[model samples]
Target: MLRDEIITVFGGSGFVGRHVVRALAKAGYRVRVATRRPHLAQDLRVMGVVGQVQLVQANLRVPASVERALEGATGVVNLVGVLNESGRQTFSRLHALGAKTIAESAAAMGIRRMVQVSAIGASATSLSRYARSKAEGEASVLAALPEATILRPSIVFGTEDSFFNRFAAMARFVPALPLFGGGKSRFQPVFAGDVGKAVLAAFERDDARGQTYELGGPGVYTYEALMRLILEAIDRKRLLLPLPWAIGKVIATVSELVGALPLMPVIITRDQLIQLQSDNVVADDAKTLADLGIHGETVEAIVPSYLERYRHHGQFHEREA
Candidate 1:
């Protein structure tokens, strides 16, 4: 809420972080986008006034680099998270340890306003390593900086999202869209723009510190229904194959192997396959986007805006934006 405040955002170059940066910049805040490679996120510089947004090369895995990134920052937002392990970027290292370093560093620098972005299914006792690591990361962050706000989002969707875009792209050429666990799992997808606003609101509210908020969209849809919606949105028809967990795991294994290539597309990891077994809707009685005073946009309104490119006639096709 305060103008001219300095806020450093980790993972500002990511799908969700870009929107968050834009929101912060529009709020008249000086934002420092810290990522592993500063050059890759150069576009973030244009999101704010001439010099309001700056980029710094910092990897969460290293404490020293994180310390340097937080110099002269009134607040910090950790949007850094990994879906799959790639060599040293494992779950424990990035999610758990990386989060701790940021929180502790912020605390050391007397930065009271810190927000950490976590997933919806994070649990210490979860069967999935990613989930467990996320739990560990949350615990680590709170332990270090008790005032830090923790945000847990369920399937964040946006113009450049991996969820809607991936499936829509596959529908372009793939004969069938694989439905994990018979596509029975349910999800409450949130818009990235809403999430960005949520981050800003959390930082402005004093009560938000030390609190955890679960963010989701207006509607909850089953995986199969969502797939059908995407098929309809793109104006394309394709087989909707219900893949068994056993078969999905095998494909996940092969995908992981192939994903190691330098330019390989991100395939479904085994942990992601496991994540599909459970529903990702907001918990009963849990706080949500409404709690932040944000009327989260529905997937119906946002998805078609960008997914039109995947259609047969691209944007030439007549459909709602």
Candidate 2:
């Protein structure tokens, strides 16, 4: 049976967005993917049957475009966020302002069901601009639609994710990996698939409305431990060097400068370094994945499958006893 509800998902072409779109499609909701480039999001069409998924060009900075995206939509999902800022894509504009625009527009359209995906460390007083902007976005979404479900997930990991893939790529060439702040900061890496389920549950469950949930995995691991896990997954041994915060800051500054040059890859940003100063874990008192009836996947189960490509001989090589 086809459902009459339509869900306009902002940033539906992104990593996490793909998971959410897939879940929504499996659950029989028609998905309208609103993105800046409809041409680039053609892959999302395969997530649903022909005509079941539609793509429309929409820019959050333009209220008119945002308003148009919500036309005939019964629900909205704001998955748009930036890990790094570029020209015209600052944190304030994308995270806070864009979120507000979506919420307010949904409210005007009388669409009460909404979900906002935020980071776990989001706070008004956070030292990192990314976290602070996320907090602002959460506030704006709630203010405009008080019943909108806010999901704060820790570092999300998947096959195409930047976190594990980045280090695994680095291990391929670099002899050592730097552990910012002595690698003591902890993280509860949550799977991207589980987060998608959480979004679906939030929309279906009445208890989730107007509530904030912190999504994390079952186990917590330190920065160093995570790095070591990446190395082990790829069957490689590399030095895990402990770098002081001051030194990491200097390196990050230089990286930012070098990244400014055309064709240069950004290894790390100063703001990202600041984020590493704090633990990216769920709080003891926060509502968890279990509350939503999701059994989060472990890094050991999923990380190794994707990281296999980074191994010597690409998974054909046998481990020595």
Candidate 3:
């Protein structure tokens, strides 16, 4: 059945947003991708048939633009988030205030069906500003639309994910990878596509409303184990240097300072280091992907395929068993 409902997805041009948009298109819902630059997101139109997906200019910082984006929309999905702060894009502005704006805008437009994506380690009292902002955003969303579904996903992994892809790229040149805090912090990496499906489920299922779901993968692994998995995938060997938190903080501080320079990429920040101190796994009693009828994909099944590009010969070399 071709649904006539339209879903406005803020940040629909992003990595996770791409998956969500594709899922929405495949589900026969008209998708309006709201982004700051609609021209840059022209490729998203092909995800569906002619006129199934359209892009509109919308900046979360601008409340009027957000309201305009929700015009004639039955639901909204807030997938906009930033891992690093730059200029006016601080964690508080984008995560907390931006979310509140979207949620409030959706509510004013009589759009109740919504999904707010958050991180698993989000805590109001966390040392990391990112996590604390995420927690604040969750609160704002629920306060505005109590029936909106909130999804807190662990480190999400996919072809374009920064997590796995970052390390795999580093292994290509770096002699050794640093294990901050001995890499003991655990994570339950969830597949981006599965999270997309969960977004669709949130709209389709009645019980999903007003519920908070913790989306995670089938297995949990430590930071060290994850690094090992990346090295194994590329069939490469490298030293795993275990660094204490103090040393890691120092490195992060320098990285942040250097990152202040124009065009300089920040490898890590002190705030991100603080975030790594906490475990990013689903709570035992919390509702999960299974609760939404989604069977989370395993990292082994999906990661290796995309990681082939990082191989020495780019998938031509025979991988070790």
Clashes of each: 0, 0, 0
Worst 10 residues of 3 by lDDT: 312-321
Candidate 3 residue lDDT tens string, 50-123: 99999999998889999999999999999999999999989999999999999999999999999999989888
Residue lDDT tens for model 2, 19-76: 9999999898999999999999899999888888999999999999999999999889
Q: Please give the TM-score that candidate 2 achieves against the real structure.
A: 0.98
- Per-model TM-score, in order, reads 0.96, 0.98, 0.98
lDDT of 1 by residue, 106-175 (tens): 9999988899999999999999999999999999999988888889999999988888898899888889
Error of 1 at 36 (Å): 1.6
Q: Which residue runs does candidate 3 get wrong by more than 4 Å? A: 319-321
Give the winner by lDDT: 2 or 3.
3
Candidate 1, which segments miss by more than 4 Å at Cα? Answer: 318-321
Q: Which ten residues in a row have the lowest lDDT in candidate 2?
A: 311-320
Top of the candidates by lDDT: 3
Residue 284 CA displacement from its true place in model 1, Å: 0.8
